[model samples]
Target chain A: MIVAKRKPFDEIMEMLEEYKKVLVVGCGTCVAVCLVGGEKEANILATELEMARKLADNPIEVDSVTLERQCDREYLAELDDKQTDYDALISMACGVGIQFLAERFPDKPVFPAVDTAGLAVNQAVGWYEERCRSCQQCVLAWTGGICPVTMCAKGLYNGPCGGTNLGNCEIDPDQPCAWYLIHERLAKQGRLHHIKQIYEAVGWRDTMPRTLIQPGYKKPEKEEAK
Target chain B: MSTDNGLKSGSNLEKILKAGHFAFTGELGPPRGTGAKEVIEKAQHLKGNVDSVNITDNQTAVVRMASWAASLLLVQEGLEPNFQMVCRDRNRLAMQADILGVYTHGVKNMLCLSGDHAKFGDHPDAKGVFDIDSMQLIAMVKQMRDEGKFLGGAEIEHPPKIFIGAASNPFAVPHEWRVHRLAKKIEAGVDFIQTQCIYNMERFRQFIKEANDMGLTEKCFILAGVTPMKSVGMAKYMKNKVPGMDVPDEIIERLQGAGKGKVAEEGIKIACEQIEEFKEMKGVAGVHLMAIEWEHKVPEIAERAGVLPRPTVE
Candidate 1:
């Protein structure tokens, strides 16, 4: 799932420096799952913003709404009041949600309140570890389930670099060397021979920012003269 | 143009190795900060005493003057440098560019190493980019030389003709697998390998014996590494702390028994003894003396070990 973290209090305040009244919109999908932007968080943030403004003697009103998803227009339609009473909107969703909301309400200033980190899996409560780089081309089958593109510090496709010490990366001891894990995994499956072949350098053309258009999915042009 | 000795246009070390001479290579670590004064001085101490000097690429992952720049400085000092390039800092883009850059500056011999992790060095916060493993790097350079092409097969106007080198660790765990790994690197087009420091002769002997059984000795030069222990503390640190390094208990005990100020001398003696025995070991080519920061000891140790007065290839 996509993982994101809330911006620090000071940075959020800086984004709201020029505004007095604000509407905080939260996403109920990824941001909610990652425990950053949800109905509860949106309410808490509203209270915190009120207190921050009160402490500064610059009193301001804040209201919030949790949309089913900030990315979907249907969910965004829930906030179609067209009431431009607020000075700005603080989106507590991923960058996609923030941009989509901005496009829907073109007149109001929309700002992101969180940084979209990466695709990750939850290791435990309050901890989300990055698992994939979304390189668009997956080599998991060949590597025995270990993702060197994201796990290895150098993103090497071949075997471990010489600096792999004690099965831990030389750069960070906490992280296991990706190739080491791959070797162990491959060895376990009796597919160790696959580790020997020299792999070709990865091409980033299709993966740089991957997008897809399925067959027969494109909108067809109007039929001209038969 | 080739030198008068009719060796390659690049490294004198390459010429020496090609001529079937026992090569004695030492390592020179570039200073952490700018200013080449310290590196140049160290090179001067090793000049003429060893065939070629390897300028480390941020040895132990601590940042230093760029290895290429240090290599160029050594070249200016009239010393052939076996430049060591690590994959930890740059991706394939910068790596390929630096290979060409080093070749243009007259570097002839190059070693590909997976650099030590950044956490072991001063900059623990920095991220590491292991874009390509050492094995792939060897193949990449070999391709650049043999086919005059990049990793993606784009032709270069002038290809870098470098003698490729890689590192080997016989002491690391899963010892039986190391020889095969060396074979893989050899298959990838490596010409020579410098093993991790040898304090465990028994393990190293087994490694070489297995390597010979696989007939890997004929394919590449095996330069056994020997770093003399400066103190028992260093020995303990290497044995317990350093990864892929093995300092046998006997050696550590021997260092502890060295008594007072004699540990350093005892360490040198042990290193000299290993060099002496390694010269007679079958399939062993020569000794790679890595006196690390103690660069001054290289000449004296080389002299005592009888690999002194490096061969003149021309």
Candidate 2:
């Protein structure tokens, strides 16, 4: 899942203070699964915000709405009728959802209510940790199920860092060194012998810049020439 | 020396919730088997930490001690229990009677839910009685409070006053369904809402804004629920084993980033940080802490977050 954490409430309130009537939009897909943009959370937040606004004596008018998926144009269209009622749009979706709302509602200001973290999976009931970087590449096959890029503190591709001691990473003595874990796993599979293979020392892409596509996909157009 | 003390005042929890910027709550899963002692012990430990204890009725499809029984125990022990009554376990008749039973015992808080499927619990063969969903239950309670009559049309001798509440899991699929449920619950006369544990504060902030825009925020008190994971492995289990919960990846990364024994400390620290963040933000009333098995860590978390005891409510 595209994991994103909700921004702190005070920051949100500060951003929202400019408007009298604020519309909070929640996205159901990615943010929903992560409990970021889901409907229930949206309502809870709306209730708290309204209460805070009232308590503050500002008495702002707030509206809560959740779209099936904020990334889609069709879902964004659903808000077309109600879009004008609010002075601002506070989106609960990931970065993509916020921008989509912004693009769809050019007249209104779209603010991101959540900060998009990297991709993650639920580790357990109340636990979720990062497992992937969405690096636009797949390398899990070569390194067992563990991803060295995300798990390793140093992000070293080859093997254990020199600091690894007693199966724990030197950076945080209490934490299992990611390399130690990788080494342990490889050893268990009798693949520790593979660790000695001379790896081609290749550099990863030098610069990693974040990018977002507006309305992400497009169909191929017809050829101009006959 | 302060460890393993007997029951404290219910105000401990109240104070904690009010002290924080936002509040959180979660169900106290009954013991794995039928034993009042285990459940009672958990409640006692959780008592002063959480705003209110939600004694769950057959959580995760598992059959265990009855919620009413457990809630009654909590109240008798001077603790506030948010009795989670699911329609899946009882018919309306039993439910009505149980509601009366609990209220008389001074257990006023409740979270209406449709119990999990029998197959989902420990006993798959168990029969499920979803006589009502959360909305219907809320509606029934509201009618009892407002009209002074039960679903059976019998006049209540003296209508009970309860802090009516309901549950909402925004992480459930068909995301719009979560909103629809909230609207329905509010319409049914819910006074407050205690949501599924949330990890993503940004989403929660947006959630608040949306609810405000929809005018739903005006209707009730919203308490954000939080559960501090004991370990990274435990976090993984919550993600894999527990249904209806959503833990964001950033939190996991941070936890996974923490080394072994440090993860627990880090989890508590994260919770404290979230609590602090919630307190500073607008549109939040209180936080309900659900420390789960780490109930003892609650006081430390609260204290660290600067949510110390108030001078005592009059």
For each candidate in the order shown, give its overall lDDT on alpha carbons.
0.85, 0.70
lDDT of 2 by residue, A99-176 (tens): 988988888998988999977888865457888866555557667678866776545454342234455654455766
Clashing pairs in 1: A154-B129, A154-B130, A154-B131, A170-B117, A171-B117, A171-B118, B5-B314
If you superpose only chain B onto the true chain B, what TM-score does each candidate give? 0.96, 0.86
Against the native complex, each candidate's DockQ, computed on alpha carbons, is 0.41, 0.01
RMSD of 1: 3.6
TM-score of candidate 2 relative to the true fold: 0.53
Which lDDT value does model 1 have at B243?
73
DockQ value of candidate 2: 0.01
Please give the lDDT score for candidate 2.
0.70
RMSD after CA superposition, every candidate = 3.6, 27.3
